[model samples]
Target chain A: MLKSAKMVMERARELAAKRRPVVAIAGAEDDDVLRAVSEAVRAGIVGATLVGQEVRIHALLEELGEDRNSFEIVNAENPKAVIALSVELCSSGRAQILMKGKVSTPDLMKAVLSPRAGLKVGKLLSHCAVLEATGYHKLLSITDGGVLSNPDFNDKLAIVENAVHVSRVIGVAEPKVGLLGVMNEPDPDFPSTIEAAAVARSCYVKGMTKYIEGPLTMGTIFRQMPEGATWKSDVVGDADILVAHSIEEANIAVKALINLRGAIFMGVITGAKVPLSLVSRADPPENKLASLALAAVISGASK
Target chain B: MTFQELQTRAQHIRPARMDVVGATPFEISIIEKWEKRGWKVRYREGELEHCLQAAVDAAACGETDLLFCSGADNLKLIRFLDRAVSRDYKPLTMLQGFEVPSYPKVLWVGFTPMARYDSIPDAIKGVSVVAKSMAELGEPEARIALLSCVELISPGVHSTIWEATLAHMSQRGQFGKARVDGPLAFDLAVSPQAVSNKGFKSEIHGQADVVIPPDLNSFCTLTDEIHLTGPHTAVGIVVGGPCPIALPPHRDERHMTLSLQVASLLV
Candidate 1:
């Protein structure tokens, strides 16, 4: 199992070294995007195809003191065209991963979700953020922080499936998912607890993930199991993935870990035909590089 | 359990003006203990209706600050008093001991969900008020954990969102004299080992003075579980009113004493 975010990146680099996955970046005119892609190529983690204005990309490459011929560059008239061309590259199997550049998040998501793009895999498209903090022993993944504002019972199932898919690609044989709630006990008054219980019960038959426990607190996942705890299981201190009840909670927690706890994180949109590298504009170059690495690992595993 | 011990323990509390209505023999026996300790107790005989009437009359005459109701099973009377008193009364149930036996004494509230406010704000206010009350009980500074399944807020998970809001409010000093952290789980709020294992650094980690449940249903279930399966004693009281009201778990001697002790602390 990949225990930390560093391990996740290391695993991706290893897999990419064995079989270099091609990554196509939409609106790749941004300097940060070019810089990250340049680093990934140097590390032998990915082969990049830049989909954007050819002239501007060439100028940036030259400005950054790079050889323009070192990589492939696809010319596009605009951001929309760049997204279309990038999605086509992945759909045609020329690229195994899709990376976002300067395009707005909604615009990039719109292109991926478009029926005409053929990138939709008939699964709920959700966001999964993998975190490596100082205190945690393993890299923890929180889902649906960027997409799916209010996921219902079935949506939660799909979210878990999506996370499980990513976990398997990262070499986790069995991923334990904690269906987070306010407390460990289920309460009907709070519908989230009720939904968490329902999800936990269905996990037995669904078998999409290895282990699932609900109404789990962060303490249960990250902290040691408390004394006199009646409910005892493996998921209590070893959860690899935390299935958040809502996007707001997932977002708050992930951001808090990153900002308050000084944790390193990478986010990718899963459930698509190919894993999409979805790095925020505010993310540093290293984070963007990690996102690409993550996509490559997921893409390699999906194959 | 004896008069001398009760006197020493309740010395910090003043001679509280209390009205006991609908007292059974068991309740009378417990009230007698307080009487022997030099506390005045006014008695009223009858059912819930009689008890309510006496309570209303006492409040009208300004004869009592606290009301003790014997054998009041449902929370209808409390709700009625809440409306009549025109103050938002939150029913606070405290687990008498630590969830972990080795841990120090702590106050856990909001086990009973608020019927007045919708789930999240109700829980937030309930927790805030209880944390404040516990501070008044001489903890000075109370560490409160507003518990949810997880610490993150989800759109459909209203309690988590509200808990987050409460935490933020506490940071802004909205909750006076209370250090509130949420949405915590039971283990995170009280287990030091869990805090260290997770590498989470929180002041309330494993040292919570109070644990607030998201709603009433969970509170009731948790109390039942602890009482039935464990050896810990659980006691409940209705606070955030004009005065603290004692709602005993049962008409047994132990419960009555526990309720009186809780009421005395409030006084």
Candidate 2:
């Protein structure tokens, strides 16, 4: 299994050497956006298609000392048009990954989730941020952090499936999915715990993902359950993926590790026809590269 | 403060009477140990619900200064206590204290998902009650961070709206004497470096004494996740009710005992 973000980046660098994928960045006029894209392009990790203000993008590239000829820049001053064109690039198979740049999450999501975008694969689109935090033995994936505000039972299942897909892409063959809830016991009053229990039962029947546990807390996941406990999930303390109940939960958690523990993270939106990288403007350049690399690897492996 | 420090802090006050609703022999021994240390311990046995009610009733009647229990369903105990004590779920804050190795000082947190509320305003009121409870705990001027996924207020995310509102209210001295701010991501709330990196100007300079998680479920998830990545000693106590209700931890026996000890101070 891929243990660290470093390993994933190395694998992506190698894959890019073999066959570089294309990334289409919507609203790609921001310096941070262009910087990361240019770095990826220069490193041969991926080809780029920038969609935004053409003149400003050229100037920013020049100021950043990058050649404008390197990328295919689309001139669209309107934010909606910029988003549509970028999504269109991926939908048309001209690009392998759709990257967010200088766009609010809601704005980008609105465009991608629109029926005209044709990105959804007949299911939900959820965000998965693969993190390798210090003190952790292996990489852990947090899901639905960037998208899917308040997921329902079915939405959560779909979110888990999407995370499982991402987990497998990054080399967790049998991903242990831990559905995060307040307590292990499913109380009727607390619908989240009950949903977690129901999701675990459903996953067992589906048999798509291995080792699904829920209503599991962070502490319990890492602790050993006593013998013959009525509620024991093996995913405790060794979960490869955390299916958060809400987007804010996952987002806050992922960012917590990123900010506090200096956890290296690569975020991607799944359940779409093409993989998506929603790099934050505040994300350091290295993390941006890693997110791009993750997208490259996912799209490359799928191909 | 750390659990050890918490035990010592309890020593500042005189030992108080405690009511144990349900316990095994091992738990009884711990209670006995406390009794020897000048605590007046009362033991009760019966059905879990009945014992819990009796314990609550006794505390309600000023019969016990401290309350601790084991064997009752955690939610059941919390709900029963909230209804029996808090009256309307203003906020029965589960104050968790963590002594993280990587952290400088012990962190205090309130995760209030114990009771249902009518609306967002009701939820914010419940959460603010937790902040008020924490305000009385350790830091007189508690730096309370209303944790959210992002700092920006977006209509799409309900938590952000709640956090922004609470932060605004906090500026107006609404959430007690605690210095409160929010719409802060976890890192920004606790990591000064992140705050600098993001150039987010705020009151919580990565040193929030209390982090009020957006929801109770996330608090459970984050608390356990923190344990996994970095095992830390923690003690949880229920506050802002009629009396301090210490829910027995699902962790090891040490935490359960420490949680009880921590509850002693709340009395």
Candidate 3:
């Protein structure tokens, strides 16, 4: 029901005030990350636990004109230890959300996927970017852009489920999922079309028919449906989630929507025990704040 | 339509004065047919080297504004005329099929080497010129579809990126007097049923006046598929210059006459 990113932030603020999820930041020396975390703390959205060098964290806090004792800082020796401690904080019920700060994504992911001290919940970890542009009627979610390379049938299913979970936490009761493909029909030459049809069939057989539709195009989801068409689906032109076949497809579409269409978005890694706030280094401070808000809301709902 | 009817339509826009050069006897006889329909037709006798001189002479006389070339083999003359008229010249081809009953007319463009457009800006430039020429030829508000394998702009798929960029540019008023929609496949570009079934909402959906492919290779393959496999009539016109130059496939009388009729509107 949240039509814009502003509404998403408003809903997240309301949920955070009710639950007050504790957010653990791994490699938390980045200024943009601290800015967003500080804003969320000021709004009473979430409490933060910073995991990094104590001296650097204190310096950043002072540089941002905040009191040194306002936040909890965990001193760690290296990036690996920082990620391990943050994951431990989330797994031990000390923190509700895990976020990546200045560390590389692969390094953070390695720690999160580590069997001994990871946040895996026996599901595939996929990335979902939630976007709200001017022309769209509601917020749109594109999934598996940053994590999965070439997702198979099961990976796509998990990706869709993860996106649906996030959408539900953000207030959409039943998210309409669109399995994106080149065309509607299943062509022998195109493997994506075949996979799309298989995914659609899987969703149908699993009694999740009301939640998904595909082999659809981006235009069918963003623009008006073709006039006088007999095909029946609720996802066309009103899709809450778009499940792409590959990382390249999802990444290109997401980047184009953000870069070309001027869409505001928040990126997160889902399908974990707790939602992970993961964003690109090029993302603005507002986007990082929105990601924090998103993590807070999803974490609160998961409880 | 008949030559007389074509001349009448041409008169509505502008009176066409044509200068023909380096054509076969059969080609000249076709222009003679237009002469019978009250068209001002002048035939200049020239070999390959004399083509540029002949076109310049025709233009200098102020009697002929449009120059019709014999075939694509006269690249030197096409280049010379292209430079003489305008700096930007894009060759536009119209693929007409009577055998396939569903979709009749499709404009396949940017196939010629002289009209090779690779980047986004060049593709948009070519499409804008062709769309404007189509509008002047009587179809106002031409629907242009940027052809690709799919509608989504995926990485490693350069055509889809170019198509998305052109569509964005068109949305931002970069291409004038054209309703452009793209990254569309061939089915969605031409078939109304495909457009309806796919649930695509676009101005050019199922009703495209011009179809600009991603590059020259795809355009060649598409044109060949339609020409060899199906019974169809295809003709090429180089626009975006001061005048339209026809680049017909063959030197046959039918093609030359049809190309001349098309060039008359732009001239």
User: In order, what is each prediction's RMSD in angstroms?
Assistant: 10.7, 3.3, 15.7
Q: How far in Å is the alpha carbon of B182 misplaced in model 2?
A: 3.3
Q: Which candidate is the best by DockQ?
A: 2
**What is the RMSD, in Å, between candidate 2 and the native fold over all Cα?**
3.3
List, residue by residue over B79-104, the lDDT tens digit for candidate 2: 66666664554457677777776667
User: Any idea how many clashes model 3 has?
Assistant: 0
DockQ by candidate, in order: 0.05, 0.47, 0.03
List the candidates' TM-scores in order: 0.59, 0.87, 0.57
Write down the worst ten-residue block by lDDT for model 3 chain A: A252-261
Q: Candidate 1 lDDT, tens digit per residue, A90-186?
A: 8899999998887876788888888887889947799899887665667788887777866888998889888888887777788888888756778
> lDDT by residue for model 2 over A12-114, one digit each (tens)?
8888888889999999898888899999898788999999999999899999999899999899989878988888898888999998888776788777788
Model 3 lDDT per residue over B102-148, tens place: 34554444433345455555566677776677667666577878776
Q: What residue pairs clash in candidate 3, if any at all?
A: none
Positional deviation of A135 in candidate 3, in angstroms?
A: 2.4
Q: State the C-alpha RMSD over the true interface residues for candidate 3, after superposing those residues.
A: 16.1
Q: In terms of TM-score, how similar is model 1 to the real structure?
A: 0.59
**How many clashing residue pairs are found in candidate 2?**
6
| lDDT measured at residue B232 in model 2 versus the true structure, 0 to 100 | 70
RMSD of 1: 10.7
- The full ranking of all candidates by DockQ, starting with the best, is 2, 1, 3
DockQ (model 2, Cα):
0.47
